[model samples]
Target: MADVYDTTYGQADYFGSEASPLLARYADWIPAEARVLDIGAGQGRNSLPLARRGCRVTALEPSGVGRAAIKAQAAEAGLDLDIVGENFMSYEPRGVFDVILCFGLVQILRYQECASLVTRLHQWLRSGGTLFLTAWHVGDPSFARLTREWERLGIRSFRSPDGSQYRLFLEDGEILKLFFRWQTIHHCEGLGPEHRHGDGPPERHGEIEVVLTRP
Candidate 1:
C-alpha cells in the first residue's frame, strides 16, 4: 500500500510539517511570475505557496494521491497549475523553466536515475536558471554501522512501517561528484538528526541542500 501509486502519491496532506529551512531558502530563489517545476511534487507544499506568489507552477507527481492533493489545493486557491501524472524521468518538457524546485525526492531515485535526471534537468533549464535539490544525507557513526550491517546481510531494500520498499544510494560526496556538470552556487547539509523516512524506518536521515545553475 505504501509504495503503490494510490498511497504513494499526494504528500501535501501530511508533508505540511515537512517544510523546513531548506524550503524557505529555496523559496527565495523563485521570482515573481517565475516558471517553476515541482518535481515529485507531493500535494503542493511548495507548489501552493509558489502559486500564491504569482509564479506559474507545474506540479509533477506520479502518485494519484499526490495529484489529487495538488488539484484540491490549486482549485481552492484559483491558481493555474499544470499537473502531470507521470514519472519525472520520462516526462518531456516543451520549454525551459526559470527555476526548478526538487525538494525531498532525490533519494527515491537510484543513482543511475540521478545521472539521467541531472542531464534532463539541465537540458530543460534556461540559461542562468536555478535548481534547488535536497537529498537524504548519511551522517553519524550509528547510521553507518546499521547500514553496513544491512549490507553485510545482502539486504538491499528497507521496509518502512507502512510496508513500503524504500531504497537509497548516494552517501555524501557521490551526488556532487556525479552531478558536478552544473555549477553549485549554494550548498548546505541539513541540521540535526537523520531522517530515513523513505529509505526505511522513520529514523534520522540528515540531508544535503544544493542550489545549482548551468553555465
Candidate 2:
C-alpha cells in the first residue's frame, strides 16, 4: 500500500495541492497555536495550510515520496512541520492533539480497522478537540460498479480484481454511530466536488463529511 502511494505521489498530483475547504468552514474553532494531527497527510495538502495558519501540525504519511514532497514544500515556505513517515498502525502518538484531520483514509481500511482508529482518536484528542473526517459511502456511484467487478470481503468491504485496491464504503450515518458520544459540529452526505486524478476523467464521490468535537 505504501509503495502504491509512493508511486502515485511520484508520478502525479494524486490529491491536488489545495487544502480542503473544511478548514475555512471551521476556522473559528481551530486556534493559531493549536496542536494538530493530520492522519494520512498526503503530500501536505491540508498540513501545509494548517502550518501556514501558525498551527503546530504533525503530518503523518507512510509514503516516503509524499513525506519528501511535504518536507520540501514546508522548507520552501519557511514553515516548520513535524512530518512522520509512518502509517497509523505502526506509529505511536506522544501526546493529545487539539485537532485531528482524517481525509481520504477510512475507505481504505476494513470495518474493524476503521473502528479501531476511531477508538484511538478519542483517546488521542484533548477534551473539546475537533475531528474532521470524510469517506466514500455505500451509496456512491462507484459502489455499484465495484460490487459487480470486485470481490466482496464484508457487508461494505470490497477488493479489486487485481487485489491492488481495497475499499470499505460506509453506510449512511455509519460513522456517526462510532462517534455517537461526540457533539456533531457539521454533517453532510452526497456527491462530492468533481476531481480528476492520474489521467482519469472528472469524477465525484458519494462522500460523507463530518466535523465532531469531544466533550
In model 1, the runs with Cα more than 4 Å from the true position are 1-5, 8-12, 17-20, 140-164, 190-202
lDDT of 2 at 46: 89
TM-score per candidate: 0.79, 0.95
Count the clashes in each prediction: 8, 0
Give the number of the best model, judged by lDDT. 2
How would you encode candidate 1's per-residue C-alpha lDDT over 9-125 as one tens digit per residue? 433255553455666766777788999898988877888788888988889988777788788878987988899888888899889999888887766555556668888887888
TM-score of 1: 0.79
lDDT of 2 at 8: 79
Q: Relative to the unseen true structure, what is the Cα RMSD of model 2?
A: 1.4
